[model samples]
Target: MGLYPDDIEAQASAIITTYRDRGWLIATAESCTGGLIAGALTEIAGSSAVVDRGFVTYTNQAKMDLIGVSAATLDAFGAVSKETALQMAHGALMRSGAEVAVAVTGIAGPGGGSAEKPVGLVHLALKTRSGLVDHREMRYGEIGRDQVRLATVRTALEMLAAAAQTPA
Candidate 1:
């Protein structure tokens, strides 16, 4: 079993409430985590005020088309790079008119693990008008795909809360 959606919803609700109190909006660009972050946020009642939008760009092409992630960056560093994550965050902020944005890209797998970029290697990026924050985390090998994605969603919400609390 995985973390329940309601549990994720509760956390997301608290974060959104905090942001709404401060009059800030948030967007998300998700790849390996799929739309789990967005789904968690939207599961909360009255999330419309704080959640601007979510982009589920699971493929290189989708990242380019939806969030304007450059093909060159994807070619150079693959979809899981910090550069791609930053670009995804920046693009979400640029396109969604949100005050803050979080982006995630990673290789979460039982397959698709190069020795360099192993399974469970996740890169997360948070972008605001003021600056950007990025993190690379390896979640102890393959903990199953769902577990990795759930962890990613939780991490993103935590980052969102931190970002919302920051002075703009």
Candidate 2:
């Protein structure tokens, strides 16, 4: 695996400090980045107070089973889609006791490129207990698979940090 980005570490630390101080917990639902978001969070000491758990739903079945991602949504919009990302984030909130949840679905590949959903296309969604959802779509252009995944992780961390800052 490639080196995890420094900004991700900083973002994770900030998130931990913010959430730990606020007595808030977080969860993650991941696809292309696997569990890197969770990994980054856990890399920080004392993250247990902030990180509740992680769902590494690398497969469609895992996504549906672990986080309640709808099969219809996956079939209709495909896995790496805004709709799926939204579902993943919401599902994580439902499944965990976390106040904030972040989800990432993407095509980080050297091979899985299409005309529309090309490689390095990532969709991130942040869901809060206040019933607000924020979605971001990133096109990192066909950077190497590790680079794309790291970029996605960084974006997810930023979203989580922002969501933590939002007033509940």
What Cα-based lDDT does every candidate model obtain? 0.86, 0.91
Model 1 has a clash total of 0
lDDT of 1 by residue, 19-91 (tens): 8898888899999988888888877778899999999999899999999999999999999888998999999
TM-score of 1: 0.92
- Report the poorest 10 consecutive residues by lDDT, candidate 1: 132-141
User: Which number leads on lDDT?
Assistant: 2
Residue pairs whose backbone atoms clash in candidate 2 = none
Superposed Cα deviation of residue 132, candidate 2 (Å): 1.9
lDDT of 2 by residue, 1-168 (tens): 224567777888898999999999999999998899999999898998999999999999999999999999999999999999999999999999999999999999998879999999999999999877899999999889999998998888888878877787
- CA error at residue 117 for candidate 2, angstroms: 0.2
Pairs of colliding residues, candidate 1 = none
